[model samples]
Target: MDNHPTTFPPAEEDPAYLVFLDSLDYLPSDDVARIKAAYAYAAKAHAHQKRMSGEPYITHPLAVAGAIVEWQMDADAVCAALLHDVMEDAGACKHELAEKFGKPVAELVDGLSKLDKMEFASYQEAQAENFRKMLMAMARDLRVVLIKLADRHHNVQTMSAMRPDKRRRIAYETLEIYAPIALRLGLNKLYRELQDISFRLIYPHRAEVLAKALRAARGNRKELLTRILENIRGKLEHAGLRAEVFGREKSLYSIFRKMQEKRLSFSQVLDIYGFRVVVENVPTCYLALGALHALYKPVPGKFKDYVAIPKANGYQSLHTTLIGPYGTPVEVQIRTREMHNVAQEGVAAHWLYKDGNESSAELQIKTHKWLQSLLEMQTSDSAEFFENVKIDLFPDEVYVFTPKGKIMAMPRGATVVDFAYAVHTDVGNHCSSARINHELAPLRTELRNGDLVEIITAQNAQPNPVWLSYVKTGRARSKIRHHLRTMQNEESARLGERMLRQELLSLGVVPISIPAAAWDSLVKASGQKSLDEVYTDIGLGKRLPSVVARRLLAREDMAGDAGSNMTLAIHGTEGMAIQLAHCCQPIPGDPIIGSIKKGSGLVIHTHDCPVIRKSRSTDPQKWIDVEWEPEEGKLFDIRIRVEVKNTRGVLAQVAAAIAEAGSNIEHVAMDADPERLMTSLRFTIQVAHRTHLAAVMRGLRHIPEVARIHRERGGEA
Candidate 1:
């Protein structure tokens, strides 16, 4: 063997960058010039700053801004992208930025800045609050959200430099918050990329395992993917259709998610890769799909024509999974160029809405409507803003149709009541009848897609408290609760005033009229907004009337002699007495009697309690005189046991019976021996009083398969 001198290859030179001027190939002259100037300003501002990975920090911001440009973002978003981190890392204030760029740009930068001065006990709490702040800011301006997403996308791309734990936390946050918002905004491409990148970091072992499997499987599909692409191109050409066909593999994260969701293992999973066909028009999308089905057996129920029914996020494509020549499942997606752009960039494509330049107006219109709802939902208290936004961010939506073909998206498991409220508060409060697909349906019926819903209204049909259990949408749930609470307060105040008057008469003390000034002072001292609020608090059990009376008496004594002990005790029932009841679980209703049990000051019991039954026969001296008084509605707990054969729908059947009987269940616990095929269920229900309790028990007893039903008091039959 001839041994020659070993030669080493010279190191490869770094890849040359396309100049900014060259990269502005398609951008308008004026727009390109503006961006070039912004680039220079940002470069100088970030000259000394460096990233954790040792790259100039300007590289990161520029990368983010470049992504924005790819999305065809407007001038404002571009500027915001360039300066997203200046305030956070450079110790610059919003005012300085405003002086340099403009108020809008500075505000966007401020919105992206975190409250770094404040210390958090845990990273989780800081992360949560930071996320809340981001969402709140996004609600105010659409550009803030777009730029933030861009920043997040680039950060994820370079996440390997961070510690594993930090990477995991960041990935989890991106998946939970950023990805969902992007999906909600119709940015499917960004959403998928974020999710896939996050998934890889969070589960590296699984990612590697899947990657290995994909490599092994690729050989089997390489020839197939190529043959399928060629066949599709030939067919499209034969049909006088111009199209571009490319092979597409399912992302590792996506395959992992599908397996997790469907409870399948690696081998059980199919449709590992597919092809995407981009055509010139909408009609061609359909025609290409037909050509595909002719070549392969289309999988039933795996076909979706989103072009006709685009998702709320504005994604439109023809998706079909087909069984190929060897019975392998292959997914194919068809879309036109415009649809493809929207599919990838989502609302970001709105940058092309104007003449030769779609401004971000279309995106602003869609996202702004949602953001406005967030603002409109602001409670009087700022403490509830973050809580409310959290509720709104949970976007498991169900798409329902109106009678006129309009699509409305509401939360999943939403009832007709939720639908009514989603339309308008007036519609919800006055809703009397609902027809889904032109047939009368119960208001609590769960809505499904493609169901044409029509609401029938009565002028006086105010929302009933019963609807709260069935309504799933937060808007409807909140509105109904608010209305009911208002009504309850008004009635409680009126009743409280009457009770106070009676007490004054029984005490042999004439009601003292408060001077206007004194009454106002009393109201203020009681921490009530109005006299009505004071009385309502007393009636609603939030305050004690006797306590208020004692305060008033002390004030009166300071002013003048109000009464003597004899006068104050004119009646035999001297001291203030209030007690909870046992039988019928009397709460604000039913005849109540005060009984002085030994050691217990005053034990109130419902007139029908078994204890009262025995007390009347023995030791009547312990019972004090008492009667029903006007009060507000309150919660009462009563238990019932149902013995039934454990059939397929026995639990559901009994629950439906009780619900129809109008008794609300506070809680339910059930026990059963599966082998014995029998079950005993205990339910703590809320009822108005004795009459309602009896009616509810009778209804449960009537349920089929209910072998027995009995009322119990603290486990006593």
Candidate 2:
């Protein structure tokens, strides 16, 4: 899929290369020559190209490589960053690069390349497919994403010369996709920068207005902020605590988001300025927190110990709000020096602190786990996969506990089903309900921090389609959807196999009697990868069974309708592939016929149902004889028209009769003829089979207010 550009640009020296050479101290002395070679290669490959800023193309890579250098990446990452765009935009191939540099560097560059060779239906489709490739490669080597973030950072900072619409579109993507990805990886510095620049580009007017307001507010609060910072530093020193206390201002974009989320004016959004106390060790972090609290009265219910249970992105700090000397609010975060580095740099801190830093290692592990989850959520549709990734890129998180007291950090609004999937996919699939803090709760219950959750699962339980509506985490939704899709495909395959077998029987043949070579030939001829694909196509009505039957049998057998008498058996649990007609509401005991409906697969109708009877004669091959397997403990919905005396308590009485007869009224509608003194109540009730319907009808007839009752089975074709 890699489209190697054939026209290589001629090499020419540029001043930007000299500046980039100075930032390579992070690379080993032996690998420095290789990095320079990569730079020269990319420089020549893009010698004639220029950015919208009119800078030589190689400077873009230099800036991206500079950012990764700030994160302290290795030699290969440096080389890969230098040549990241060469394979996509310049004349280069992965094999040549791999032979020249190394496979690792070449693969990194390959991962960063866009899928420009493919045609997509929309811009979103193209972006999603490219991201899908990049994400998959990221799961293999995390440096790919690091280089990508650095690349995105540079692009976002240099997009002023682009058209307004393109600028807004890229800004939207940077904010929605890349910014969250940065935060998800714990790259706080890059995340905030990307969000702020994107917010400016997307809403220029709002950004400038907010910037002006912030400038005014900053001047007014300058003296107060200095005083507070000095007070915290003095107290920490007085308490024998070694700490670096600094004032931190919220980013303009973060302020804007807070205003929008909370619906507040700029003046109403307080706590824009905060403080951070970086200490020598973990114990000193708490000591500094205590010292800061001693300096000012702590605000009530305004403390969070993220260090105890880190956020989903592996962010850890002791955050607290205090009443300052002037009676205004001051927010402070306490953390160790290593925690601060990891907080700002995120996964890149792994390589920075590769010398056995426990906090950095933990963050690396958590990030890899999240990346693996993203990889596991493989969907056929690239856009859908992108959506699932967005779902996982949650900004807020809540920490909860399992029944065994183990902590699990989930998205803020995640429900019990999300928690279950977070535990394991099988657990989510089999989850029936949950116990929250020793009390029974529904599956859709939104979890709270510190609540002990115990998933109640059943062996035979399956994921309900309704779970997709409320489950917050993409892991749960994707797992449930994957299971349901597999189930439907399997059901369709089974039904298609049966249909094919029945057709074969009419031609005096059995499926097993067909040779393996014959089936393989048929599969190949049908242009399907395997026999299951052929069957799935036939079962879904995308391919006609009669046509397939003719292909599998001799020409002499096609002269008669011998196999037309064969009936296909229907299982009650043929989910998604088999639809019971809404008009007839056929139960297990009802005489049923199957109609192949385009897009819907197959619909089962009662034998005498008016909806399919006309279609049955007009299109004879569309209808097939089907018999029910009569599954136990399965409920079927049936509609009944009940004529009742026009009375106040008559509706309640009819409902009670249905309930007494062991049926549930799913829905009820009334049609009143006031002058005739009679009312028609249409009730949709669930029953086990036709006999259960008979019992409900008999119970309703026994009611004194009931004049007539009969099953309702009328619909248009």
Candidate 3:
């Protein structure tokens, strides 16, 4: 009811529309006219439609347009906001809107419209698809998202009239998705409002309690905050530095999160209110900080210089916590007026594009870089893209320096691999090692603020698959996955070609005798673009090698020589196309059989493996005969479970036993069973063949502390 209209107010009578028009006074008359035309068209389209609150549907768009205008958005954004729901709610077509309003406004409206004609399996799927479409539009032009935030804001304001179930769902989504987007875009006020609204709707009782508590605390702490503000202002005035000091309270959602995260009661959560000092220039910002520190006893390790290194969203301020007059902890932020505007408005300040300001260009460059990254990730699946976007939403940043003194902002808990990728994809791909603060560290080492990072690269080095476990940033994760996928395709193609050649040899036909024309014919028959694609499909197990080989032989006019029986050889280093089963971990001496998995190539499992036994019984046709070639000095991973006495030095003794048997332990884990007197240790070790693994197990069995030892089958401990 705060800002919601309940009737169709005339254009001149509507406060929202009037405020929107007022904001557009600086725009050219032609642009203002175009925006007004859009508003009229939307109002006409929704003439008979009413909101759940019994308000004219036009009021919603008017409210949304007003919010966008408050952000100082462009005229195009304002027009788009007014028409965003027209295509979806009123059956207005994009072509008609384009003819009347323009292509840009039409496209924005089209992007916001849900795919209603196509049926979805569930509400969640439909919602996700809609969000995906909206994000795609935002990637092209950020105004789409600006309009979307406004729409969500107005919806939240009136959500009290909706059904409880629907309200909860919408509120949860707004909190999880839209609120984060607002924060990432630097719309702090919008972000905070969305969060507080959603929090109240989702937990009304808790919100009411917290609101009452906050009001009581505000009344009790009024005098203390006033004294602190006055003291800081006096210090700045005495220091000859002009400043305006004001008390700022933390938002309801922010307070709730802090309480929940720290498991603290409201009374225990001190320093809930802070002070902001707005200065004249950048230098005055530091001067104000010095003055505040001199006036109050500064709290050690409670200061951050964001002015020197801004946040990823280009927020700049100097934050310091001090011990106030009555031993109360008070936090203070100092920034110039321009910096304060950029901090509050975020990307909007840049998009507003005021003349005679270099800050606008700088802000534009920073926003464009972030937007380009989002566009690059658009090729990913909808779920994956959404996840990556969420990861980038909360940028709890840690600033680390390159060896050349160039500072890079990364998410806190980000590892060296993330830093390497942030520098460049090529550098990340070739990165082998790193040195943090002049000391050698693992690639998975967590980087700290102000640490100098030096990445060591080797041309032959490649991104380890394990890097995905530790890297934090979405850009790094997406790039690493992309590189690995390309590498997998190439490796699969090579392996597929070898398998086909071996199948041809089994048919008593020389593989070299197959001409280029035959490959082309096979490519056409298989509907693949090239021979490599056909081979890659075969390698990925999408098509069987025997089937492809027969097709090729038929194309070469040697169909009579095709053989039904073919055997594939494994060399223990088949790369991506052929994977050894981790459950069985078959070695060269083990009796291994191959199963053609869909899109995963050949999976090799031990003959006695329980998983392979079950699969063979259920789907016998998938089984293919495979033999390990006599490749000398090839290591295969095999797991051995050892039951050892729960005594001191028992783990060390077992490790020593395996090492003495000439086996290298790759990984070790203790099974979780507190009641058992004996502890179970699962070890993944590298050995040459089945005989080597057997010898290692026998050696472990001979240890006095080892109660039992055996090869783990099908991942059983």
Clashing pairs in 3: none
Which consecutive 10 residues in model 1 have the weakest lDDT in total? Answer: 566-575
Candidate 3, residue 294: Cα displacement in angstroms equals 1.5
Highest lDDT model number: 2
Q: Please give the lDDT score for candidate 3.
A: 0.83
lDDT of each: 0.70, 0.86, 0.83
Per-residue lDDT tens digits of candidate 3, residues 106-154? Answer: 8888888889977888887677677878887887888888889889999
* Clashing pairs in model 2, backbone N/Cα/C closer than 3 A: 506-563
On a 0 to 100 scale, what is the lDDT of residue 275 in model 2?
A: 91
After superposition, candidate 1 runs with Cα above 4 Å error? 1-51, 54-59, 88-91, 115-133, 161-163, 352-364, 380-399, 410-412, 459-470, 481-512, 516-543, 547-590, 593-626, 629-717
Q: Which is superior by lDDT, 1 or 2?
A: 2
TM-score of 2: 0.90
lDDT of 1 at 279: 92
Model 2 Cα displacement at 235 (Å)? 3.9
Write candidate 2's Cα lDDT for 324-434 as tens digits: 876778889999888998899888888777778888888888888988998889899888898888988874888889988899988889999999999998899999999
